[model samples]
Target: MTSAQICIMIAIIVYLIGMIYIGFRCSKKNNSTDDFYLGGRKLGPFVTAMSAEASDMSSWLLMGLPGVAYLTGISDAGWTAIGLAAGTYINWLIVAKRIRRYTHTCNNSITIPSFFSNRYRDEKKMLQVIAAIFIVIFFIPYTASGFAACGKLFSSLFGVKYLTAMIISAIVIVAYTTLGGFLAASTTDFIQSIIMSVALIVVLIFGVETAGGIGAVIHNASELPGYLSMTLSYDVNTGKAAPYSALTIVSTAAWGLGYFGMPHILLRFMAIEDEKKLKLSRRVATIWVVISLFVAVFIGVIGYTMSKVGALEMLTGSNSETIIVKISALLSQHGVIFALLAGVILAGILASTMSTSDSQLLAASSAVSSDILGAFRKDSSNKNGSMAAARITLLVISVVAAFIARNPDSSVFAIVSFAWAGFGAAFGPVVLFSLFWKRTNKWGALAGMVCGGSMVFIWKYLIRPLGGIWNIYELLPAFLIACAAIVIVSLLTPKPSKEIEEEFDRVAQMK
Candidate 1:
């Protein structure tokens, strides 16, 4: 390898070692399943907020969003960011405190499935089983997308084989996660969030400067038809811009709805040391999200400008996602110090990927071991056995996710979108109603889950292909269908028991 390549590899290696060290240090706290799965509800406000957003952003922030902006201009990407930012703020404001309090009240539930099952006082464990199954189903692909990003990063930067790079990435994430569980994942995610933010700002400032400043970049982009318009899409075939409709904008913004149902993010809320601090966490998270998203979108705009000026080469189609990598590589051309900084920024890509992957892996493993397997066994209270089962399940899930990511042609954005819809539609309505609406019964929850989950598939594969208005995002339609189902079913069925209603009232009245 060249000296530049060696430097980049060393920087990445050091970062990986640091992650593993954190995991090892935290592993000593894993005496029970609660500690492993929920960090014993001991995370601080800053760590809680930063880690949650870091895991939620994933590699999509650095790669997918920028890629879309690079190819289609800011309209699509900007609306999506607006949607996500709004969602992040609203979720923290409305949902975080209640969920944290309710989870503790309901048998100290350690996982989402357990919380749902406990909330309804389900003795048969049907809700827990179904929730766990859905988590595994949706999370596998979500996790796979992160692995795919690793493959792309390595293959593009170091000339590594795609599969080989993907495997190595999977192994590193699995190692730290399996060793330390939730505590390890959250701690490292906090550090990664800082790295990701710094990388975005540094690269954005340098990229704009290289492209002849922000004014020049904006001028060049505006010259292209519809490139800067929020209400038009550029059509490559006719070399013209087409009107963007309200439906399309709504669809793009609906990405925010995904936040309510994301198990990985919700776990952060439940793990915070004190529910009162969530207000502080909310502000921190919102500020970080807004700044990071703005920088990310601009990085794509800068990449386009730099490519046009011959300072960087533009990648087309799905390959356009490498625009961030291209920008980082160009920065390395300046000198030795800049080359090392480029390596650090490249490590930011790995940070984004590993942060999300570890969370997904941990969530999936907890679903299988603590929620699924623990439900069936009489020795479910055995902390040692549960912890061992969690590690083993994590390994199995990592292998399955790695296999799914083996396809060289997979698009990170597409995979994440589908999984995002699945979770949003399936759990978002249930979570909202379960917390705020006293009328939601077990039957209603079940109906909502089924309708929401099924509608995503039906809409995406069946109705969406018909085009026209049906082309709207599946999450919006599926989410509405799920909500409607919950209301109708709950009204038709018998009211929740007095005990359930009383508990709900108690939680609602909490400060």
Candidate 2:
């Protein structure tokens, strides 16, 4: 490796060592499955807010969002960012406190599937089984996207074989996560959020300066037809503006709906040290998300300017996702110190990937171990036994995710979008109805999950291919269908038992 490469690598190694150390330190606290999965509901307000958003953003913030902006101009990426920002704020405002209280009230449920099963008193474990299956199915690909991002980071930076870099990165992530569990994940996530913020700021400033300042960046963007317009998308092939309809904007903004069903993010709400402190978390999370998203989208504009001025090569297709990496690589060439700074910027990418991947692994493992397998076993109450099962399940899930991520050609944004749609459709409506509608029972929840999840596949593969108005995002249709199913199924079925209704009232009435 060259001197710059060596410096950058050294900086990354130091960051990884710190993360692993935090993991090792936190591992001692996980004496039971509750601690492992929910951090014993002991997260402070700042940690809760930062960890939740950090895990939610993932590598998509650094790679996928900017890639879209770089490829199609701000219209596509901007609307998606707006949807996500609105979703993040609303999820925290509406869902965080209630779900935290409700999950705790429901037999102190530790996982989303368990929360559903417990809320409805589902003795048959149908919710657990179906929800667990869905978690495994959807989350594997979500987690795989992170692994793919890491692989892309390594492959592009050091010219290593993609699979080899991916496996090594996976091992590092799995090591810290398996050792420390939820508390570790949350603690590291808080730190990673800071790193992510720093990385974004560093890159945005560096990129703008290299592109001949903010004015130049804006000028370059304005020169491209429809590139700066929120209502029109730039068509790269035709080199012209394409019509962006109202329906398309709505479909793209539907990304916000995904927050309701995000198990990992919800776990942060549930894990807070005190429900009263969620107000602080909400404000912290909302402000950070809004600012970070704006910076990420603007970076794409700067990247295009850099390309125009010959500071970087023109990147197309999946390669556009590496625009941030290209900027960091340029920063590295300035000298050893700048190279080290570039490494820190690159570490931010890893932080984004690892933060989300750890939470995802924990959620998927909890579904399999605590909700699925634990329901069948008489010794489910055994803390050590549950802990062992959860850890083993985590390992198994990581292996599966790594395998799924083996293809180097996969697009990080595409995989995340599909999985996001799956979770949003399958669980979002059910969560809303269950929390707000006291009459919703097991039957409704079950129907909603199956209908919503199935509809995602049907829409994406079957209906969306029909083109024109049918080209709507799968999440929009699936989420609506799921909500409709929940309302119809709940109304048609018998009302929830008095006991369930009383508990719902108890949670709803909480200050």
Go through the candidates in order and give each one's C-alpha lDDT.
Answer: 0.92, 0.92
**Residue 504 lDDT, candidate 2, scale 0-100:** 96
Q: Which residue window of length 10 is worst by lDDT in model 1?
A: 233-242
Q: What is candidate 1's lDDT per residue for 68-137, written digit by digit as tens?
A: 8888888888999999999999999999999999999999999999999999988888889898999999
Model 1 Cα displacement at 219 (Å)? Answer: 0.5
Model 2 C-alpha lDDT per residue in residues 214-297, reported as the tens digit of each score: 889999999999999999999999999998999999999999999999999999999998999999999999999999999999
Candidate 1: misplaced stretches above 4 Å? none
For model 2, the stretches where C-alpha displacement exceeds 4 angstroms are none
Per-candidate RMSD, Å: 0.9, 0.9
Shift of residue 329 alpha carbon in model 1, Å: 0.8
TM-score of each: 0.99, 0.99
Q: What lDDT score is found at residue 395 in candidate 2?
A: 98
